[model samples]
Target chain A: MLVIARHTLRETVRKRLLLAVVVLTALFLLLYGVGSELLARQIRERMLTNVDTALPLAASMLTLMGFYITSFLGALLAIFVSMGSVAAELETGTILTLAARPIRRWEIVLGKWLGLATLIAVYLIVASLGILALTRWATQYTPPSPVPATALLILEALVILSLGMLGSALFSTLTSGAVVFMLHATGWIGGLVEALGSVFDSQAMVTAGILSSMLVPSDALWKGASFYLQPVTVILAQNASPLANPFVSATPIATSMLLYSGLYLVACLLLTVRRFAHQDL
Target chain B: MTVAIETVDLCKQYGRRLAVDRVSLQVESGEVFGFLGANGAGKTTFVKMLLGLVHPTSGVAHLLGRPIQDPRSRLPVGYQPEQFRLPEWMTGTETLELYGQLSGASRQDLRVEIPRALERVGLGGRGNEGVRAYSKGMQQRLALAQALIARPKLVLLDEPTSALDPVGRRDIRDLIRALRDERVTVFLNSHLLAEVELVCDRVAILHEGSVVREGRLQDLLKTSTQLRVVVDAVTPAVVEAVRPFAHAVVPNGRSLDIELLSPDHVPAVTRALHDAGAQIWEVRPQQMSLEDVFIGIVRPRENG
Candidate 1:
């Protein structure tokens, strides 16, 4: 398993995927720093009576947007990297030699998952921290719970990674990519429905949203992270408003939902291994 | 001698069609065993079952005395697939190192063995080149190198030389001989009958998911029922006299190619020819090539 993991890492690097990711990440950070600096400058020039409250609100909102985009980048990386893990190898016949080795089939799936998991973890840490640091540098403000927020963001990416890997084992590369993307879109739409439910006070809409989150908990994880990253004032304000908005979570994800997401990740990994073990190559 | 591979009534069914039908075979250690079959004849399916790449629908198979389901069974086995696909981004040495480690070779052993394996396959100093840059023949050599790097007890090569030129095929033939000399069991599957005839000690010919023929190489090719007889005269009476002894007789310039119904009729045909007053110069039995035997076995079944 270690050998396979090492080989996977090496292959990813040699294919230049990692290099492309690094360049794109650097460009994103540059743009983010410039944007945050300009926003901070505009707020400073306004000279409002409640500048003290207005400044922190503006900074937290900007930081939340940065974290949002970081999470999006992380999720895209996770999906594209893992979507071809098994299906591409099988398609190209490269899996024949690897599968014929003495290692068990589960080890192959887990080794690839570990390698990609490491890559995603590192990217999330760097990108999330970079956003937090840049926002603080420009606005002199920080979120109340940055550590838990970043951890939640990483978990969200991992959940998507597991789903992509499972799809790779079960379908062709193109089909796997399409299926995982659709599931991800479903999670995002469900989050929107839940927010609208709160605005309209509709229990039925809220229940449907919760069920969809149960199916794919990517949006739930993001909401959990958003709860950590938001200021107390913003949370109170969002709760007081009757308008629907997808970005702010008035409440944290339930403890049960977080546990379910963990279980969901494990289930996806186990299913991938089982399907690959029984599949004919 | 110990049995390297043993399968008893093993089968594989893809949906309604039975791709492999109750194939039972035993190949001994240190023997070069040839698996012959036409396309879709279940040759690749059988090999995959032995390697545990495909699960058997029923019955059982064992490799090197361990059940195929046991991962340990493949610890001493090496395989070069017919498709011969390698990770294009990896160098030759990296590919060998990866496979060697998966086969449980120590890092120290691979450091020494990788170079030697590459040299054996004629890759030598070119080990650092990526596989994407390699030609078909070079890629084949790299695939063969990885298979042998661990010094496995059994090597399964499917169409081991399909992409090679004549010289490369000869080199592979020589390599097989060298492996046989080292007491490694080689289960070779190839459409090149001539190469099999040159290197295999025993063979099993599969037809429609069944072993139609299996025996020692010499026994399978030795003295078919066709006999060639040279006569001094081209007499009508001589041909007429031997017609009853043979199923068909084609008269050449000075010889008669007679297809006998059985080997028991050899002496009777000689006597009849002598009684017709034709002087016989030479009489010999015909030896069938592997192609002749394969066509004869597969074509008839196909037509029927």
Candidate 2:
């Protein structure tokens, strides 16, 4: 299993896609740093009333925005990297010799999952920290619980990664990518609807959103991370506003929902292993 | 002799189509066994079943001594698939190392064996080159190198020489012979009948998902031998006299094509022609090629 993991890591690192990812990540950090510095200066010059409250709220929103984009990038990387992990090998016939070896079929699935999971973890850590450090430097504001926030962010990416692998095992590469991407989009839309429902105090809309989140808990995970990353003052400001926003949560994510997301990740991985083991290659 | 491979009523059905049907065969240790079939005749499916790549519908197969379902059954086995597909991003050495590791070879041992395997397959100095940069033949050589890197007790090669030039084919033939000399079992699946005829000790011909024929190479080919005789005169008396010794005789130009019961009947037919007062110009023996045997078995069933 470790051998397969090493091989998978080496192969993914050597791809030209990784080079593109590195360049784009650098460009994104530079842009965010410049944009935050300008925003911080504007807030100081223009906002004279409630300066303490407005400044921290603005900085927290900027940090949340950075993390939001980071989460998006991380989810895309996870899906794209894992969507072809098994299906492409099957299509190209490379799995024949590998499957015939003495290793168990579950090891192949687990090894690949481990490799991609490690990549996603590293990306999340670096991108999240980069955003946090830049926000701290520019605005002198830091979230109360960065560790749990980052952990939740990492969990969201892992949830997507495991789903992508399951899709890879069950469908063709194109179909798997489409299905997983749609599931993620559904999860994001569900989060938006739930936030809107909360603002209007509509139970039906909230229930509908909850159902979609049940289908794919990625958005719920992000909401949990959002709750952790927001300062109390920012949460109050967002709650007072009449409009719904994705950057701040009025309530923390339920512990039960967090437990469900962990189980969902495991179920996807287990299903992937089972399906691949029985498939004819 | 120990049996290297055995199957009993092995079968694989893809929906309504029976890709393999009741294929029961035994391959003895240290022998070169050939598996022949036309397209869609289920040769690859059968091989996959033996390697646990394809699930059998209803049958049992054993590699070495363990059941096919057991992963350990493949520990001492090596396989070169007909597709010859390897990860393009990997170097040849890396490819072998991955496979060697999967086969349970220690990293320390692979550090020595990988280079030796590459050298054996004519890729000694080219091990560092990525497989994407390799030509088709080079990739084939690399594939074979990976299969042999662990020095498996049984090697399953499907069309092992399909992508090779004449020189490459000769080199592979030599390598197969070397493996045989090392007392290794080789189950070769190939369409190159001539190559199979040269290297295989025994063979099984699969036709329409069934084992239509199986035997020692000499035993299968010996039954189709014919004697060709040239006589000075085409007379009814000579034909009538040799009729007792030949199974069937057909006149072709100035020669009589006679199928005798055995090579021992050759001298008897010659004496009979002499006794009929006919001058014997020349006598030659013709042995059937493996191609003839394959076509003869598959074509008739196909037509009927």
lDDT of 1 by residue, A1-281 (tens): 88888888877788899899989998999898999899888888886676688788988988888888888888888899888999999999999999999989999999999888888999999998888889889988999898998899899999999999999999988899889989988988888898788778899988988888988899999988999888888888887877835765868878998899999999999999999999988
Could you give the fnat of all candidates in order?
0.88, 0.84
The CAPRI quality class of candidate 2 comes to high
Query: Looking at candidate 2, what is the lDDT of residue A229?
Result: 82
Give the clashing pairs for model 2.
Answer: none
lDDT of 1 by residue, B98-209 (tens): 9999999999999999999998888899999999999999999999998998989999999989899999999999999999999999999977899999999999999889
Clash list (residue pairs), candidate 1:
none
What lDDT would each prediction earn against the true structure? 0.91, 0.90
Candidate 1: regions farther than 4 A off: B234-237, B275-277
Candidate DockQ values, in order, are 0.90, 0.82
